[model samples]
Target: MKTSTVLIVILALAVVALVARLFFFSKSTSSAASAVMENLMTRTSIRAYQDRPVEDEKVEQLLRAAMAAPTAGNRQPWKFVVIKDKQTLKAISGHFNTMKMAEHAPLAIVVCGDMDNTYPADGRDYWVEDTSAATENLLLAAHALGLGAVWCGIYPMQERVAYLKDLLGLPENIVPLNVVPVGYPAENPKPKDKWKPANIHYEKWNGGDSAVR
Candidate 1:
């Protein structure tokens, strides 16, 4: 074959290879994104847990995820108390009627908001929102790690708050938000679909047909 014709043939093969590589790359990227969505959609509140312990590395990952949450004005007013002692867990379960599941779980993380470290002015209440976001992240991380967890709320309930403060030796500035019990799942439950069409408003409340597309 002529020199020009040979070069053209080589260029064509190179183009074909490049297209194939791009196609596979796009597919793999989409698959990875779908995996993340699947994890989020499948995560459910697991109250029953097996008699198994979570690994230290997984616990670290859960905390890492918790702290990665966003905070107001970067105040990041949050603290976590990791409870693994069996007696303490039992005490928690016994003390709070709503937290009976804690009696059996191997681990519980107490998410707290630090009043002294957060915004002191109008944004003072932002600590509650900040710590709540961290709690959600911790729960998702636990589910992703194949461990079960349920958020047992504490703060806002004066009795619960005071009890945990004394039990966990929390400081005056630290406020317990919730206790998350995590362990190997003893039962599997489907995630609840909370989508509601009537609850959505387009631009304003009662926006009418303009909301529909």
Candidate 2:
């Protein structure tokens, strides 16, 4: 074969290889992105949990996921209290009118924010945001791990806050944010339709897609 023809064939083969590589990479990337979105969308608040307990390794994985959450200035002003005792779980269930699931759930995690890490003791400590992010990460991780969980709000409710603090022996500087009741799922609930086109806007208020619903 002529050198010119050989070079042309080599170039064509190289182009094909590059295009094929890009096509497969794009496909794999798209699949990964779709899996993530599906996981997020399908993850639902599970209130009915089985009596089976979560294993120690799984629990650790959940906590690890929570600690991975992003925090302001990397303060991570968070503390976690894991509850496995039946009596303590019952107390939490009884105290919160809406958190009855805590009674039978095999585990509960109290996500708290540390206030002493900040100045003034009363300013925007940013603890709330930091711990909130941690709590969300925990929930998502639980769902991914085939565990069921529910968020029971505790902070902002003065009486509930005081009760939990006293029950858990938390210091004045630590604040309980939420009680997460977790266990194997006993019931499966559908995720709510939360897409609201009217609530979304582009660069400007009028730039939203009108056809979205």
Candidate 3:
């Protein structure tokens, strides 16, 4: 179930990847962008973490990477809550059944979407999209920095969302998106094989074998 949950979190981000690229990442051959791509490809969800504490400077680096994500209309509507307190982390760990790693992780960043800063577009909220993009950036940054991490979904799951809000003392207008546990890796999980020509169709999606079965 933990593995499936991780995969679900990944799929959710991947679904918005095209939109992310369209708004934030540009097609570039520069060494920096190339290095970023390398990090993206090799990053894997880390579920087990060491007992050591994560440095403050490294936390700042991850936040910087998250803020660098593209926001719709430059709204940049994201509020981050960093959790380091052992009791608080243990409380959160106990509450979220799938996030046992939080108990051992030195840091957990709760990414929230500031509804006050988001505007309704076509009668739909875009805060989720903007915040999710930021979350993906953060995960990548963690991997690049040699810190293991995991993305545990919170928003859209009303019960989990409310629980985190009360635990973290977030305002009603702020919605907790997810909990990211950060620390040195204690376990290394293998990456899934996602490159499939069966799902790829040039020009337009040919309704042939392109369906994800």
> Which candidate wins on lDDT?
1
lDDT by residue (tens digit), candidate 1, 27-57: 9999999988988899999998999889999
Q: Pick the candidate with the highest TM-score.
A: 1
TM-score of 3: 0.80
| Regions more than 4 Å wrong, model 3 | 1-34, 211-213
lDDT of 3 at 81: 98
Using lDDT as the yardstick, the better of models 1 and 2 is 1
RMSD of each: 2.1, 3.4, 17.5
Cα displacement (Å) at residue 81, model 1:
0.6
lDDT of 1 at 68: 97
Residue 87, model 3: lDDT of: 97
Error of 1 at 65 (Å): 1.0
Tens-digit per-residue lDDT, 106-147, candidate 3:
989999999889856662378888989999999999999999
For model 3, how many clashes?
A: 0
TM-score of predicted model 1? 0.91
Error of 2 at 185 (Å): 0.7
